[model samples]
Target: MADNLRGTSGPCPACGHVVAFDASTSTDMSVETVEEAQNVPISFTRPEMPEEVMDMTPMVDVVFQLLIFFMMTAAFSLQKALEMPPSDNQEKTAQAQTLEELENESDFVIVRIDRDNNITVDGEDAPSDQELLNKLREAKLGQLGQGVPGRTGLLVLADPQCRHETVVKALDAGNAVGMERIRLATVEDTAF
Candidate 1:
């Protein structure tokens, strides 16, 4: 009986919208009831596309874990640094003036290391690295031949045959005790 109306166009009988609907075409007229229409399978005239949506929860979790791992490890690392003198000529003039000013204001804390790895601070022997640190701290606080209370400068007179690690240890001690001005020089055996 529905085929008798084939190719015929008419106004919508359900919503009364005056829409020109063809009988042969698919529309809500084919759906008998709301509950039964929900059970009907969808038919497509073209090829069906696949759903390939990606899940980012695991990726975001891994990124946050790596960030936390690096942050925790970064705290346990030791940062060693050394400040070098200026290289340009204009800065050299400024550096010379600074040296002259320091020479007038305070005496440097002198540390000497011989070829046999013997360390001395102001003519006193420092048998160990801890002793060297203690002596450097004292020098930074005690009167450095001046009426002032402390010496910010440190001078290391090292012999050529000494180990490089020994020199590094001396410099590290000076830096630890807040000695801002550190200078290194080579000395002959007779000079000590």
Candidate 2:
């Protein structure tokens, strides 16, 4: 069937052509606006950005530092297990022995208090005093739940420069967990 519209096959009612142009949707704006009607006003100013593209030197440095931090923190298996040698004093020597050395040994709970009061357990740093206690409790509970033989103990390695308050806090934490087998590790020459 033939379609009825403005132009079909042949042209020539207005400006003669065989082709038909698609109409635009926008209204024609031949007139000027109030702003444009006025004379060329003062130019609005904008804050200037850096003319040259910014160098990423500082950003790269920070990224490298973060990378280094991650690299340094990445966990690795020890080449050989650490062993504590027998001390001259029998009491210290007996206490110095690791759980692995004991025949009917139980899992040990290790608490390390650095000079700055930073607490570490099983080679992992605890963020706060509460966290340290929680960790100690978990470790103690884990040992108790294991149904292992012999006595469970908590070994605290304190730095010589560690504050008295920090040591007391560690003691308090150990006490909170009902860990009585507490042994303090100190350097031979260091003043307590």
Candidate 3:
């Protein structure tokens, strides 16, 4: 039988701590009754709230504006194109002051026109201007493979006092054999 006390004592269901209940009424209730009352189910659901959406139009507009700004600031073309002859392997030949005497000059055939308009190839004097032009033509057509990319060409060194006519002749010889690359030697400290 249950005690006739008007209040009851028991462990709290929520905190597990000892709790006391009033039992001052006409009948007394047991600790088990209070424990059972405390064990009733409780719902723990949050209140419903409306969902939110973010706008992306402003972010996309900013990206497009940045793209346009970069495109407008970029360079479109080069102002000048430098046309320079290919540099020969420097180690293969001993460098000479003039193109005519380059040691171990196996590829390039030098054409040096002196102040007196005398022409020489590899230190050997040419009999005449016509002979030098002929040798250049032959080298271009057969040995140098003129008109082809990477084909070797003539390195002409015209003395400062050489006539313009001599330079024109040398250029003509180069053009005749389809040799487009012509390198000229210039003395240091000479005014342009």
**Top lDDT model:** 1
Each prediction's Cα RMSD? 13.3, 20.8, 16.5
- Which sequence of candidate numbers ranks them by TM-score, best first? 1, 2, 3
TM-score for each prediction? 0.50, 0.40, 0.37
Clashes of each: 0, 0, 4
Q: Report the C-alpha displacement of residue 176, candidate 3, in angstroms.
A: 0.8
lDDT of each: 0.73, 0.60, 0.60
- Worst lDDT run of 10 residues, candidate 2, spans 1-10
Q: Report residue 54 deviation for candidate 1 (angstroms).
A: 32
Q: Write the per-residue lDDT of candidate 1 for residues 1-192, one digit (tens) a residue.
A: 144344543344444343332456555456444344334444325877898999999999999999999998885767678776566666555434443353345558888999998999877899999989988888888843333568888888899999999999999999889898898888876778
Q: Judged by TM-score, which candidate is best?
A: 1
Error of 3 at 141 (Å): 4.9
Better of 1 and 2 by TM-score: 1
Model 2 clashing residue pairs (backbone): none
Q: How accurate is candidate 2 locally (lDDT)?
A: 0.60
Off by over 4 Å in 1: 1-79, 84-106, 143-148
Deviation in Å, model 2, residue 60 alpha carbon? 75
Model 3 lDDT per residue over 1-192, tens place:
134323555565666766555555434333334445466443446988878778899999999999999999998984433245576687677454544354235456667778777776545566666776667766655543333223356676778887888766776666665566566674322321
